[model samples]
Target chain A: MKLLLTGSAGFIGSHLAEHFLAHGHEVIGVDNYLSGQPRHTRHLLAHPGFSFVEADVSMGLPTDTGPLNWVLHFASPASPPHYQQHAIETLMVGAQGTQHALDLARRSGARFLLASTSEVYGDPQVHPQPEAYWGHVNPNGVRSCYDEAKRYAEAITCAYHREHGLDTRIIRIFNTYGPHMRPDDGRVVTNFINQALAGEALTVQGDGQQTRSFQYVSDLVAGIAALMALPGPHPHPVNLGTTDAITVLRFAQIVRDAIDPTLPIRFVPLAADDPRQRQPDITLARTLLGWSPQVSLTDGLTRTIAYFRALRAEQQPVPTSGPAWMRGAADAGQSAATPGD
Target chain B: MKLLLTGSAGFIGSHLAEHFLAHGHEVIGVDNYLSGQPRHTRHLLAHPGFSFVEADVSMGLPTDTGPLNWVLHFASPASPPHYQQHAIETLMVGAQGTQHALDLARRSGARFLLASTSEVYGDPQVHPQPEAYWGHVNPNGVRSCYDEAKRYAEAITCAYHREHGLDTRIIRIFNTYGPHMRPDDGRVVTNFINQALAGEALTVQGDGQQTRSFQYVSDLVAGIAALMALPGPHPHPVNLGTTDAITVLRFAQIVRDAIDPTLPIRFVPLAADDPRQRQPDITLARTLLGWSPQVSLTDGLTRTIAYFRALRAEQQPVPTSGPAWMRGAADAGQSAATPGD
Candidate 1:
């Protein structure tokens, strides 16, 4: 299989690229080094089957690539802080980037898989949200950048499937954390681990009662690959994440226990619009892909902690400030004009 | 107030324009005549201080009517059937059109008001959804063109406020019905009314237990004007419709009674992703706008019924098909890609 992987140097994208390359597929990895680092996929640079392109997918796909077998769109910021920082870019990549990839997939007749997120289910009312559950999203909130963009991206993808007869796959990915995650990715796992590793108190927001189910990246990639391999045009989104849910407080303790065993947890006020609970019901994934998460949270956390520790030991910058591209347009004074501006 | 009203020839837009015109405010009306009909605002054509521009805001605003005081962006295909007919156009207009309007508002230093919808709340979980209720939305569903597009529009609007300090108002309008509504509009009120008035059995989908809260167009326009006139920069949305909800079956019975005494009703399969129950909690509107829907459902229904009766009496050769622009697009086919095609 020949694959075009957008955001190939970002966390999940890099892992996905490695998985495909290791499986003997020729991989064309593309990233603007925006949120991604060269080192993430730099190891694959020497691999004959792995080639790289430095480009933004929103600008249009490379004009030269031949017809490909699969197009995995994993671009766009996933985390809250990252997306909020680059609102317009986040939106454009979701709109323009997804369209460009879908156009490529249509021309090449490849199965198109979009990496949708659980954030689409903003503070859901359902206990274990199913694939059919329409999300509870605040469109005008600070988090709208991620939630609304993913929402529109999913809609456009389905339109492409219905109107153009493209074979499309959509995965509503839940909280995923694993090795290669930035030391300060602003996600719970990375934040807790980095705090513990630095011998600092772990900051757990809002009494730590808010819950989330975190999927190990390996398990997430496994489900994605299997779903892509399946036949038929089931365009409905499938929830792809672990069902094991835990409160932020508990997760913080677990991380602290695994890393320092002595770090104290401090609580802070929760961010606006933060979900009280979120646990995906991956029944559809199990029934359709015959898959469930294989890695336990403890195992995943241990591996992730070790990866961060190694990077710290090597004195490598975790790129804590993020790539230059993650800076939101708001700060740059190039913020988009409203009807008046 | 000097107001810029997009889609000023459509149902709510035209009525709002007339209301503002009668109130002696300058109204700069713009419409591409997509779903808009000139006849709705036809009377205002001869009035001073009422200007109309035949242009698509999705591309960009035509001439910034310098130093405008208010902006009411009522563009985009609001009806479900109309939006579903031209999926891409719905998304584009909601996104790009809103963006252009937002830019224009920013440039002119005018307050921006976005006419969002109850569709933002999709098939809701809460009995009486509040202004802060994140919506239940299917990102990949068929109805997403309108639902998700409104969500995207609201998101961008909010971003403009938060990131750029734009003075913006968002009103999540519900099922508003009144005079000038397209005769065959697919909204339940119009659909049932048209069928009953035509001496045909009214169509009720599923068991008809699904509920909706209807806001009379006058009340909605009032709420919109109130919000737009609200001082300060509160970025949160305000639900502008009434909480007086009724089941679809009950509403159909009322429509049947109102239109024709002996009309029968038929049940059909519910449309995909249709909300089972929906009702807004307008506490915020009451507190914020000092507004609540003033017209009773029966009174509003009578007026809407009268308007449709007159429209039918005229034996107008108006197309009962779908959105005018979409119909034109399909008829023009190859030429549809060009502007003004």
Candidate 2:
């Protein structure tokens, strides 16, 4: 298969590109690095199956990325602070970026997948959100730049599928963390791991009582690989995340234990429009895709902590060399070597 | 004041352009005629203070729309049937159209207005939804092309105001019906009026028991004019809809009585994702804009019936001449002469 993946310089996207390439598929990756780290793409450039295009998908796909079998849109800044800082760009990338990617897939007669987020559930009124749940979203709030934009992206993706006979898939991803997450990305998992590794107090938002379901990146991309390979008109959105819900404080403790148990916890004010509870009911994914997360919270943390520790040890913002922990993440988590390896 | 109005050939936009022109304001009206009827602007084009630009706002605002004090973005396929028929274009217009209009406003140092809709509420969970009620919307449903698009528009509009300090206003317009509405447009008011006038059974969706609030176009334009004229950093969205909630059955009966007392109603299957109860809590509009619906249902229906009757009698689809009933809407409902006059 030939594939075009947007945001391939980012965490999930880079992982997706590697997975497809390892499966003997040709992959063309595109990104402008607005929020993505270039070092994530460094290893993939060595793979003969992977090519790179540096451009913003909001304008359009670059012309030279020849015909494709599939186009996966995984662009846009995912974290709250990053999206808020580039609100206009985030909104543009999500809406226009998704449109351009869908257009490319339509023209190429390729199946399309849009990497949406659980943020669409928006402070879930339902304990475990199903795809059937219509979200409670603020259209003009500060977080709306990301939330509303993703919703709009989902809307446009479905429009293309129904109106243009385009094959499309949407995965509402819950929190996922592993190798390649930036120390400054402001996501909770990286924040705690990096803080613990740095021997600083782990900063937890608010009371840290709010629960979240976190999926390991290997588990997430594993689900993505299965979905891309599965053939059907199976057009509905699927939830991809661990149902192993945990409180922020408890998750911070786990991270601290993995890196350094002596690290203290620092509490901070919660951001606006933050979701109180997030957990996905992966009934459809389990039944239809026959997929469930494999990586345990403990093992995933041990691996992610190693990557950040190596990152800190290398003294580069995003390490240039393919550290053993990073390679372990790319190998679908089988490798158990420590960062020193 | 000089104003640039996108969708000026649209039903609400034409009325708005006329209002501003009558107040000695120069107006540049733009439309692609995707959903807007060309005849809606026939009268406005005659005014020395008014000019027309035929272009899609989604592509970009036409280059020739001169200097302006305000830019009102009202260009999208508003009716469900029309939007569904042009689903992709509708989505494009709402997002890109809104962005282009905002960019033009930013460049020209003009205040901006976004013509959002009650549809943004998307089958409200709260009765008489306030501006603060985060809406209940289906991101992948059939109606999402319009609903999510408008929500995206609102997000970007707020982004412009917050990030760039551009003055902006958003009005969540409820169902508005008046002279310029396409006879075939699927809105309940226009549908009922045209059906009764054509001596056909009024088509009512579902059981005809669902409640909806309909605002007269004159009342709506009056609110818009007031909001645009008054000056401040007033940034929150305002509901410019009426609280005159009525059942579809009762509204159909009123339309029938106005046109032909014996006309019957034909109930039809409900639309997918249709709002069961829709009524705006317009307290914000009443206090901030000093506005309320001045046209009673009876009066508004009477005028709307006259316009459709005039349309049917003319035997031309979208009659080109500016009939008295049409002029009455432009005058903000002061003209009371019968269509025969």
Task: List, residue by residue over A1-341, the lDDT tens digit for candidate 1.
Answer: 99999999898998998899889999999998768766766667878999999999978888678989999999887777888888877877887788889999998878899989888888887889998777777787788888898899899898888878899989999999987676557978889999999999999999898888888999999998999899888788999988898999999999999988888899888988888999999889999989999998878887888777766755533254865643443233222220100
Best by TM-score: 2
Q: How close is candidate 2 to the true structure, as a TM-score?
A: 0.93
lDDT of 2 by residue, B23-104 (tens): 9999999999998877767666769999888998899986556667999999999999999999889999988999999999
Off by over 4 Å in 2: A316-341, B64-66, B316-341
Give the TM-score of chain A in candidate 1: 0.92
Tell me how candidate 1 scores on lDDT. Answer: 0.83
Tens digits of per-residue lDDT for model 2, A30-75 = 9999988777676678899989998999989976666789999998
Candidate 1, residue A96: CA error in Å? 3.6
Range of the 10 consecutive residues with the lowest summed lDDT in candidate 2 chain B: B332-341
